[model samples]
Target: MEIPLSHFEEYIDEPLLKRGLSYFKNGFVHEPEEIRPGDYEAVVEGSEDYTVKLSIRNRVITEHSCDCPYDMGAVCEHVAAVIFYLEQEELGLTQNTKKGSIKKAKASSSKPSKRKTLAQQVDDLLGKATHDELILFVRELAAKDSLFRDLLLASFAQYNPNESKTLYTKQVKTLIKVARGKYGFLDSSGAEYVSNELSSMLGLANHYIRKGNHKSAFFICTAIMDELISALEYADDMDGHLTDTIYDAFDTLATIAQEDPPEEVRKLIFKYCLTSFSKRSFSGWDWHLNFLHLAAYMLSTDSEMEELFKRIAAIPKSSEYEVKKAQEIQYDVLLKRKGESVAQRYLEQNIDNPSFRARAIQDALDQKDYEKATALANEGIEQDSGYPGLVASWYDWLLKIAESQNDTERIILYARYLLLKSHNPKRDYYQILKEIVPPEEWTNLVEAIVQEAMERKPYYRTDLVASIFIREEWWSRLLDLVKKEYTLDQLAKYEKLLAQHFPSELADLYAERIIRYVENHVGRSHYRTACKYIRKMIKLGAREKADEVISQLRQTHYRKKALMEELDNV
Candidate 1:
């Protein structure tokens, strides 16, 4: 789906860079992805912590279902990368000749030359053909559906509900109406055959629903739903990944309600969606999830969904979907299970796990299982009572859940644990702080907490304390921290960490780090983040301030000694 760079520039089409800059204060690192020829689904490194099944085909995106709150928001970077990569690909075509010569020639060929249809063209791109061949094939077939194209570009981020949407917009919707008139509704034998099936599903269902034929609409929609699920089962590489596809189908289905079924039928249909989901064999903690979606569909309406949810809770252990989903969906299901039981079960199963347990807790919390979460947090503390180790898993676990709950005292307590017991955990605490208090609030916390800690001990947690001053956003603090904390000898250690971990933020550090690097570095003043801040500062009527910061950064104490020493050696 990548377009040519020239086409990209001309059309104001957002590249991943522009896209990132739009959404994030700091530019996003767009991890590149590739087309898996085996399935034609786009593939990227999933957040190792969560099981989001993201894929792309044609220039269209189909993301895996995520339990993260952001999932509904379309917040995952994998999805962003998949979508942007597809655009990058479509535009990658602009570099080639605009002759339409390839298209003419491909059309002349008798072979299954791969650009005959949208689906086929997608198949061709996913094939081993060179980039040029793929684009040529696609361009030959690519008749831009203007409204459809816009619907796509608009929905890529999933960052805001008001901005994007849970389903298609008004204009693109005319497509279904237009097509339904052409094709007509009421395909007999309760089966359908159509190209662009999701599209056809919309058209045919709308045709029936528009006529007050809710019976036909529901029937056809269910058939299309079955086919969509069947397609997921049929896809090669993404075969096992049904959660995402199912959710997409669910959301798509939500939009197709021509007339809300009678209260009786809606309840009946809701029960079927809930009860029948157990018939399938779902994996991991997924089996229990089917009900979550079913319940969301019902509860989001005028009807009371709690009794239905209670039925799900009352499912014997003999039922499918597993315990995690059960505990997680308690609030949504209206079962009123304590978050503590859920957390205890999760912790008991996940003991001896470290890097991944955070992921587990986040997922559980995503489900609103606060009681089990509290229990798990308490259990983690008891399992390892020693301060250093206990705080590693336990205190941070509570802080993580507390952040979601906005428990400032819990956040401060965990911050104290890291500051007091493990100086090395400074970086970890700051990273977590971003999730809790945000960047603007960090300094206030630092001022209050660091001062309090200093009264209790000398050197009050050295490793991460310096992180607060790295932001050019807070210039005065940066200068003060550097001047007060580091001696001439310690500058080397401090500068190295800045280069490695805090490079993006250090640009605002009065440019001392960048200036020092100019001597040893061939790319003089080569820091990207630093240069970016300089421009930002200039734009804000702080040109003189910017220059002064840059100069001080260049001439600072032993900060530049390494750069100079290295340049001389070279």
Candidate 2:
């Protein structure tokens, strides 16, 4: 049960794990205390303080819970941070002080002498330096690091108001140039690194905002967004770091725009949004829709709003789908400027698309018009029933409305449809059925779904189906299905699940797999793999079978020295 650093990744999402590592590196986890043997608790500072408790049984985390509102059914960032703190302590990367906080342990001594940090030393020197000397020192420093020079200029550009935009534009260009590699390409990690640097620039922009330099901040944010959008084509941003940074920059601009900025800033934001929208290169992306929404929010004059309407109307209707998206954008803008009634009217006028129909249903629900919402929801499902993905979405909407109205019958009906009829199964649907259906009826309901899935051509064994069987401890049915469809290699992944209900059967299964593997493959590596499985089979009560298989192999492949050597070791 001694957990390695590698095991944590299996229990958490990579992004959350990375964020947790960042938190631990920045000392955000504090005051880890042992509540008792094998149990520890700590507080992690995120958007708010969250307490995390970890139950360590034999050094592996058996259980963890956090007082954070993350409902993803996996470990959250706060709990991950606490786990990282514990990992650091276990690895001797940190030392606990008397106050319970952890700090880096000194290698040379148990207690290290306090010394001024480099920043403090620099501050002391700057405090004693003459004004002329300080100016010369800054000039030299800026010349040494171009990035620092750009940041310095951008940070102080508000004082030189006339040149702020030019300076920021130059900074964006320089940063983009630096981010590109020799072939003008950015890999995923490079994209992330560039994004982190751009985020630091955003930090400087936020500082300008806090200082009430709205124009400077607005220009900087817009420049970043524009340049970042241009960089997207060159970077392999599969992890979405660059996209998230762009969204953050846009949010800052939107927040400032909400304050009713000066006309100049408003026009600049408005123009930027329009230019971004008109760019054909940026089309077919959700961010394009977001840009339209921002432009709608920034529409200050009737003439400006009219211009937006005309521009949207002029977008070529290349396909039915593109036309629908254009109409949706118009409806969003109308919803913001005009009212829900106007938006509904616009939606009705353009209700040819399934997405628009879904929107109308949402609008009905927003107005508490349950009848209208239900009718629209049903209509959407009926029209798009041929498309399982679309029908699933409509079913989800129906379920939402049913839950809001406390209509148990409708909830059960929609949940049943989602469970049985939909190709894509969701666990929440099963949970809903479980909650609303009587306990006596739950088993029958699950059996009916399983039977239905079994009756399908070459039976569909999905995670939902597997989870139901496992949750109910229906081991026989699960094992039959697994044996029918899964190979020996795949079965290895389910040893824990299989061991829970069929230890002897699992042992036999592993023995059969090892015998087949050893007979088919011949090599030192294959022999090693076979030996690994042989050990597992023995651990699970198949020692006799494993010994027989090894004896037969040794006699048959007696001339193979490597195989003989591996078997001897085993």
Q: Find the candidate with the highest TM-score and give its number.
A: 2
User: Candidate 2, clashing residue pairs?
Assistant: none
lDDT of each: 0.45, 0.75
RMSD, one per candidate, in order: 18.9, 14.6
Q: TM-scores, in order shown?
A: 0.34, 0.60
What is the C-alpha lDDT profile of model 2 across 75-189, one tens digit per residue?
7888877777767744465544546676783331101214543456677888999999989988999999887787678656656748666777777776666656445676554
What ranges in model 2 sit over 4 Å off?
1-161, 178-197, 232-245, 280-286, 314-329, 352-356, 359-378, 393-417, 426-451, 458-473, 488-501, 514-539, 546-570
lDDT of 1 by residue, 127-151 (tens): 8688898667655554466544443
* Segments in model 1 whose C-alpha atoms lie over 4 Å from true places: 5-197, 229-249, 252-272, 279-290, 293-325, 328-448, 451-477, 480-512, 515-570
